[model samples]
Target: MSGLLCYCRGGFEPELAAELGERAAAAGHAGYAVTERGSGFVRFLTPAGDAAGLSRALPWRSLVFARQKLRLLADLDAVDTRDRIAPVLAALQAGAVDGTLAPRFGALLVEHPDSDEARPLAGLARALGNALRPALRKAGLLAAKDDPRRPRLHVCLLAGDHLLLALGDPADSAPWPMGVPRLRLHPDAPSRSALKLEEAFLTLLDDGERARLLRPGMTAADLGAAPGGWTWVLQRAGLQVSSVDNGPLRQHVLDGGGVEHLREDGFRWQPPRPLDWMVCDMVEQPRRVASRMATWFREGWCRQAVFNLKLPMKKRWLETSLCLDIFGREAGLPLELRARQLYHDREEITVLAIPTGR
Candidate 1:
């Protein structure tokens, strides 16, 4: 069926499904979501058979739950084991002729869904991708070499013989496969949680903004910075940091003298003056943390902020929407806010907020 196929974190299919349904309707597309619990994916089927139009209506970065989004081309089931590549090639050729898909693609990504049930297919995906490259190039469907500027073709394996063919536009979709960035923790980092902030900078901000805003010598504050994981990231980025928490930090983090640890409660502490950035990862209720974050912006304490909201609630999407609404309205300013459930995050979402004029 013609629809938008979205990949999300395992066990979050319901949230993603609900988001797709509401978003598609809001974008003036009539569609119903089809998903299985813990399946790690959702399909929003449109009877109008306008998957392309719907995909265009919903931009990838606008989505909170989805890791990757693709326009459905065909769903091939029960394929013969002897020749798995033939059907995919056929689908590509047909779609190209019908104007449903691009005649040429920049890249081909063969990926499995992100779920325990689908993990075993990783090897098969890798093998099939290697096997398909030559045939696709010979058929003139795939480029001889990878091109980052063109659209990508996706072959997502629902099962060994059950394949979902889709197309991804580079301009609108995640650059990484499965929408998960592969980042390694720095050995000098005080804790593994530092990766969360690193990923936030990469995922939340564009290249130009990163270059313009996060220059060396910028000042920042890290609330709840015990053990100094987030504080270390700010320091590594060449920012002098004020680490606020009522606990001790690693001695090495202090050795550089870039970080100043304060023995104070995160919620109670305030920057003495305006700063370039403020980050918090305190374990608190989503609304309380959001309201506190709004205080920072409303009071003109910081120009930009990146924080996390702990979401152990049953209705996560509702909570996410409510908390974001509260943050925006309470801040009482024209702020650009972006949030995502990063791969490193568990039971939480990371948010970045900056004033529009900044």
Candidate 2:
């Protein structure tokens, strides 16, 4: 029943624990150890009941089968450079180097006596990639040269003898790939903040889920609407948005009839009529934002909401718990709520909640 758990972000334990509960499809915790800040090796009760199935289900490349004994494999002095990494390349060729086996988007923990030894590790990864490219093509895990676009696969380089790779099956690929090489890595890319948070948000959204959250002709209020990122998202979904903030929004966002700009204090302002949606990204204490969200829900001022709660300097898990509890107690409505440290966010968690009825 003991296995490893890998999380996003570096050095935040409470956030990782909160993520585990939020991702409730998994099993209970037995014990866990932080391998690195954002990532960890854990021994937990396997939800799958079978060891092999659990191993297959979890993102193992980012996570390793540490079993119940949380031991660190730090015998760097004895490591065989070439031999240690061969099996990992073989797994990548076989298309077995999945996110669970190797995290395609997390950090690797490595220690070298000097920078000289670390150079080989970097060289080895490049050499392995050279070997993997042709093999992946032969396996049909990669697209043929004639294909209009070469599918950009997700990859992670770990410190140990492992290569984490996520093959982008053509049918399931994103409309536009993010995070991988050759794709223009935008400075404002949403999924770049924390891998786990991005994963959680994507996991929560499907075509149906997104459609359910958005409705045509719905009136929306967006707090902290400067530069109009969230408002941009809502307007694209065909909702009419009143973007509220003292700061100016992007001229294009305001030019459209779908969006209106209002220079006002979001906390103090109230809509003349109940809004269909309320979204906020204000930089404030999480509890205050949670209380305000609860008020909107309880007062029937908004039927559904999405907002970001900025976590404190420490104890992020405690803050998330407190916010959730506050909402549950104060909202006084049947609610379906979800929170994740989104890929688009930094030092804050995004929450979505909907009342039971339309």
Candidate 3:
């Protein structure tokens, strides 16, 4: 079997499947998604030898629901438990012989579906990594050392006996294992919501963009900053923040002398002057939130912004498309907008927006 394998949050299989199908078709690829409910992964099946083309056509950054995207090389089934490495090596060698893969891969990533049923396989994945890395090098299928500029080989264990061999482009795929970043809650963070923003920065922005954009002494405002989770993240980045919310904020967040707690409704409170950044995490209707965010860009209230859109339980894809349209059309500026359903997010997706052309 051959296609593209997409990793996503467990319960969002349907959404990821829908997105894959639509995006693939839009990219002029004829494919069908094969997945089950809560599978945590989706396989977009294409005709033989078409996976490579599809992978090039659909860039990873364009996928909102997919945590990682890999081009399926081969899907092995009914492998013996004791000799699982043989089938994987065989698949990679076969692809190399056929010119479907490189002679040597730069890196090997062994992963599993992010579901409760598959969680137990994590240990097996690690063991396989240790056992297979040498075998891969001995077989001349892996480079002497890891190289970030070359293709990344992936082994995804669907079950003890079922696995998929795939290739990931280091330039386009997520850099983390299982497409999840290892983020820990900080002790100084007022609430767990801080992790959401941290993950957004890591996932949405590249290293160069982060260094260029988040300089110290920048001005920012955190809408609905009660308990000051997002505010805490911004202040830590050395941005002086106005924490706008009617509710009380954590005293430490305000004690940094960099954060000023403003008792006002987030939607109604506008920055007194153009600020460097504006972020909103208010739990309002998605359209209302999108519209307000659009107004910020339209009126030049902030240069860049990161916000969240709480999706409804049903028709999330439809809602996401409609809300993004409202935001883009209403903003009335060329904006660099990137959004994702982050690992820390539950039913909502986070968005990062920046106005273009000064």
Error of 2 at 354 (Å): 2.5
The TM-scores of all predictions, comma-separated, are 0.97, 0.63, 0.97
Query: Could you tell me which 10 consecutive residues in candidate 2 have the lowest summed lDDT?
Result: 64-73
Residue 299 in candidate 2, Cα distance off native in Å: 1.7
Q: How good is model 1 by TM-score? A: 0.97
Which portions of model 1 show Cα errors greater than 4 Å? 96-101
Taking the tens digit of each residue's C-alpha lDDT, what string does model 3 give over 1-358? 4688999998898888888888889988888999988889999987655777788888898788999998877788999998998988887777632265556889999999899989999999999999999999999989989998878889999998998887888988998999989999999999999999999989988898889789899999999999999999999999999999999999987778798889999999998899999999999999999999999999999999999999999888888888999999999999988889999999999999975532
> Global lDDT of each model?
0.90, 0.54, 0.89
> For every candidate structure, what is the RMSD over all alpha carbons to the true structure, in angstroms?
1.3, 8.2, 1.5
On the 0 to 100 scale, the lDDT of residue 7 in model 2 is 29
How close to the true structure is residue 54 of candidate 3, measured as C-alpha lDDT? 84
